[model samples]
Target chain A: MNLYYRGYLLGDVRRFPHWSEPSDAAGAEDAALADETIVYLRDDFSVVRSPVGADQGVLWDAMTPQWREFCDTVLRFRPPRESADGPA
Target chain B: MDRPDLGEQERGQAVGLPYIVQGGGENLADRLAEDRAAIRDRLRTDGAVLLRGFDVGGTDGFAEAVRALSGELLPYEERSSPRETIKGRVYSSTEYPPHEEIFFHNENSYQQSWPMTLYFHCVQPPAAHGATPLVDTRRVLAAIDPAVVQEFSRRRWMVVRNFHPDFGLPWQQVFGVADRAEVLKLCGDRDIDAEWRSPDQLRTTSIRDAVHVHPDTGEPVWFNHIAVFHMSTLSADLRDGLRELFPEPDLPANSYYGDGGVIPDDVLAHVRDCYRSAATRFDYRRDDVLVIDNMLTAHGREPFSPPRRVAVAMAEPTDAGARP
Candidate 1:
């Protein structure tokens, strides 16, 4: 898929919610937003804020709240899938 | 400046080989709990991701980070290197002699099932060198001669391992079971061909794809132990010594064509060059945790002076047969 983390500028998530550039090239931060917001990634790439009090994001795994927002937001990143009869 | 530490790397060199996630001294386990999926996606895209300046308490804390990011840690199976267990799922990174450099290899590439992710935690930076050099398998594949790649793809490659009494690990240790029947059952299950040369000596052979498709990225990658498992890859001194000590069929470990034909020495040399052309490295600092998407990147050790300590964990099982 086109969605990949080529490179990104790191910042305090508090100060930089839209921390990473939307494309592969590294660029200046889009310092326009200041809340727990899902920003731009290619259409396939998405970010969700970890659910507040009760609205658990569409996932069942335990995670730090911030990550709860985007756990299943990307490629089928479930735990390594195994069958009732596991890997040979 | 030539040392290639995180600051020097971020200053605009190494092509930002793998994206860096600066934790700003935050507890890494905590950060992992928050955005493991996003972090993992970043890793899958970059082939590797460096988690620098984070607080990974110790072996215990490192396990916490692994569980947070990977959900479960895969136990060390079909063992090769001598790794000492420190805590649950956290083991000392390949206790090869401190002065010997390990050639580049994807972990468990020869096996039927392998971990999709590997996390290396640098507990203490080595005194001199000891950087874990990394090679993008996609880049390695791109650099190889297409003919060489195609020939290997068609023929596949075979690994012949000899567990001897004098040289190499005993089969009991490698198999982790003392019972011969259990070992045979495991071999049959894993599709490995096993033979008993002598009562205490065992020889096993397995054939696997030299090129494999990345599970997430879907790109065909040059992924195999063809070179590393070949006899010619060793230094002339060691190669000659081993040859003199054992018959060709009884060497500690060696590789051949899937049909068991000899792979020319020249082909092995060309393969090594492609890996070299695509390799990159960064010096480790204490608390630098490197998370690798195992299929996308091949990693190796650079020989270093003593006092270097790195912890490792593997997770996310991906079956080899699942790929087309």
Candidate 2:
């Protein structure tokens, strides 16, 4: 299944990636190492952990530290259920 | 298609053929009768019929041919865009792409008085891609519910005109109205109505529902959104969203709002599904002319590679009046 940013429709996402290196690197000497360390996401998400073929740009941009922090906070503070049985 | 009743004098005579030599023609009366009879039958049953070998002499001969057969000058104002001077509208698939699906609709549906008959001549055929598709509005209308038909007859529809100003040419200039009163004046006060937004733009006004009954045959016709509202271009976002909401609406990209605006989400979804499940398509070939009752049928183009060229001629009976 595909994931959406906010409440966007599934088809709206052009690309998605899995993992990546830190956004900032020390100097020019570490540029090559940073590039190699990054992991990308695939559109189909079949190989979620493989990082064999994923969109590098999407992984780097959409999944920034800020976005991750947002996701973390939302997960930690879940809203109370309206009903015990669940919404009708 | 055989008629043994044709007399010997009419056997070899060309009835609808415009370029056929007439000086030594066998019996003009019999040939004319045959031609008229054929046209009448086609109109009554199929809503349209073709006059094969009507005239192939040459493009220059087209005007003369039309004058002799219909006893009227071709409307110079109705020529296709860019070449208004040309006497006939050209339709060719080789020049245009098939991606632009023309909506199924009656010709001049927006006009107060539409032509009674329309004729097309194919000058060239596409290599593999273009085909003209048409749907009998009458057939569609006959199959729907009566309440739906009543709903349409009660409303005033809108058509937004967005064509560029000064487009028609020296013979005729493109003009638009802004309100129902002006629309009535432009259309000669036929029951058909419109509302203009700008000098060169307008909207459909006073439209019937998606289903209506033909005044002549009393046969129910599916003369609704598929023909009138569906012949326009819309934004990709709105189009996709509407399609998603109404997965089966079969909404083509062209259909849009009366103000030339995006249709509302809920309304779009509702109409899209209704059309998707009920509409049928037929392919048209080069030189294959289809005669249809403007009130009973809706015509649309299937998207093809450009430049799509199709020539059309409209014929109105002497007494039909200018009311579509």
Backbone clashes under 3 angstroms, per model? 5, 65
The whole-model lDDT of each prediction reads 0.69, 0.37
Superposed model 1: Cα runs more than 4 Å off: A1-88, B1-15
- In terms of lDDT, which candidate is strongest? 1
How does each model score on TM-score? 0.75, 0.49
Tell me the tens digit of each residue's lDDT in model 2 across A1-88: 1110111111112112333434332235544332112121232221121111132223234545554543333211111111222111
Candidate 2 A-chain TM?
0.19
| Displacement of the residue B252 alpha carbon in candidate 2, Å | 17
Among all windows of 10 consecutive residues in model 2 chain B, the one with the lowest summed lDDT is B14-23
The alpha-carbon lDDT assigned to residue B258 of candidate 1 equals 96
Roughly what TM-score does model 2 have, to 2 decimal places?
Answer: 0.49
lDDT of 1 by residue, B1-324 (tens): 011122322322223345567767778899888877788777766777778778888888898999898878888888777888878888889998876677788999889988999999999898766878777777678667889888888889999998888666668877788887789888989989998888878889999998999877787788888888888887677789999999999888899999999999999887876675445556678898888988888888877788999999999998886454
- Scored by Cα lDDT, where does model 2 land? 0.37
What is the DockQ score, from 0 to 1, of model 2? 0.01
lDDT of 1: 0.69
